[model samples]
Target: MSSDFQNVVPDTEHKGLVGLLPAVARPFAVLARFDRPIGWWLLFWPCAWGIALAGGAIDRWDLLLWLLLGAIAMRSAGCVYNDIVDRDLDRQVERTRSRPLASGAVSLKAAWIWLAILCLIGLIVWLQINGVAKLVALGSLALVAAYPFMKRITWWPQAWLGLVFSWGALVGWLAIVPEFHWAMALLYLGSIFWVIGYDTIYALQDREDDALVGIRSSALRLGDNVHFGVLNFYLMALSSWAAAFWMLRPHWLAIVTLAPISLHLLWQVTTLKSADGDDALAKFRSNRFAGLLMFLACLVLGQAG
Candidate 1:
């Protein structure tokens, strides 16, 4: 790999376990993205929001931990699967060209084996949840399986990712309540928009390469108006969340808890440099904090009674 390609593989330089692991294991770690925790954090937050907003997370903290573990494992599995499917495309993209599969650091057979191991871990975590949650979680597999192909088939792959990533909210809620409610649905929808917005930001890093490779992404579709598009998505997300909160608590103050997250998102849009990959990535990674803020809002609102 060229030095330029090496520089662009996200978080490859992070001196985490991927760095400390023996050289043989490093490629697997890279393939699974253990060195880049932002992906799992993004996946875990909606799960936390659902649990916290349903009033069970405070007491059943073990459930939150299980979901977190599931997020890490499943996100890794999803990445491995995506890399396997997109290996050709990955080799063409500047940022992803150095990825384990594309760079031939990990063989396809080994990648498949690693994916199975990650899914096995996810299965253990899934089994710890309630039967309803188990069923709900299982349903996400179809969405997950279809996601890697969305870029080839549609211009709105980020939208499909929103649906897939935000399914965890439903699973988390059903894990505790075992009953469907409008508030949970609204929360899930809100999270879908949230994923769309952040993933759009993430896609900005690849827009040029994506265009050259004929991969469709919201960032490429939006063109120069990407900032405005992100603002609209964030506004929609906040609106859905506000409605969910109002439905759950019906108190004027319950909606106020979202203020911090709303402001944080505002800052992200306002400060975003749409053309700078580093700036785009910084804003994208900052969603981890955004997730924490949203989780805190849910925790407060869920405990309000």
Candidate 2:
């Protein structure tokens, strides 16, 4: 939850269970991003997209639970590792200065330990998945480990994030189907572009800080043309989703039913004010709803079939 971005200073105002908890409990929460659940939601949506779109029936309640838990654990673990690696850079940025690692509330050693704990939880969840899905999930570790360094090396770090964040889409589909399908592959690609679009919007919030810190981001890459770039990415996202849908269900009505989600993405692009960091962040966060809308459309199409 980048909401901490708004309050650079820790809110020492209300000190209760969170503040009074043992020293051990405090850093773990920060490591897990208990203060910010949105990251988990963003991570969870792609899994939902893969599962619901496969039309393989959602009777596997156990698998759904595993995916849900895995999303939370892995997202938290990713954030902890990212913060640990970026602590120096984070200290230079106002929005990130107060982060546990950056602010020295948690030591680097402690952060790594917490990261291990979260990853252990993730591994436990991964073991609950099928062999194919488990292998697919394990394969994402390299991407996740290298993501923090991508901003330093590439102008399009969001594209790298697209790969990291949307890996669950593949795992989700594999958990159900256990075999490759062109339709699911297209849907995974669509989710990647969706992550790139929204994460670009998120990066817009840090453009100034990132520039000063010598960090690269799609927002900096696109600059004044970020809005147009976002439009293009979101448009491509919709097109890929539409292609995925039509490939699975060739009916004209399926494409028609996708209209609402497509219109929503259009609204996101048309009304987006990239110059306003708050507006851009709000729009970025709104993708949770966009994801849900798309999932509902998938549900309808899957059920209708």
Name the top lDDT candidate: 1
lDDT of 1 by residue, 54-112 (tens): 99878999999999999999999999999999999999988888888998989999999
Local distance difference test, per candidate?
0.91, 0.82
lDDT tens readout by residue for model 2, 1-305: 23443243342222343456665576567656765667888898888777777653357656767788989999989999999889899899887888778877788888888888988998898887789988888889999999999999999999999998988889888888889989888888988999999999888888899999899999999988987998899888889988988988898888887788788888888898888887887888788898888878777776665
Q: How many clashes does each candidate structure show, in the order listed?
A: 0, 0
Q: Report residue 247 deviation for candidate 1 (angstroms).
A: 0.5
**C-alpha-based local distance difference test score of model 2:** 0.82
C-alpha TM-score for every candidate: 0.97, 0.92
Clashing pairs in 1: none
TM-score of 2: 0.92
Candidate 2, residue 182: lDDT: 90
Q: What shift in Å separates residue 76 of candidate 2 from its native position after superposition?
A: 0.2
So what's the TM-score on candidate 1?
0.97
How many Å off is the CA of 59 in candidate 1? 0.8
Q: What's the lDDT for residue 171 in model 2?
A: 89
Query: Candidate 1 at 285: error in angstroms?
Result: 0.3
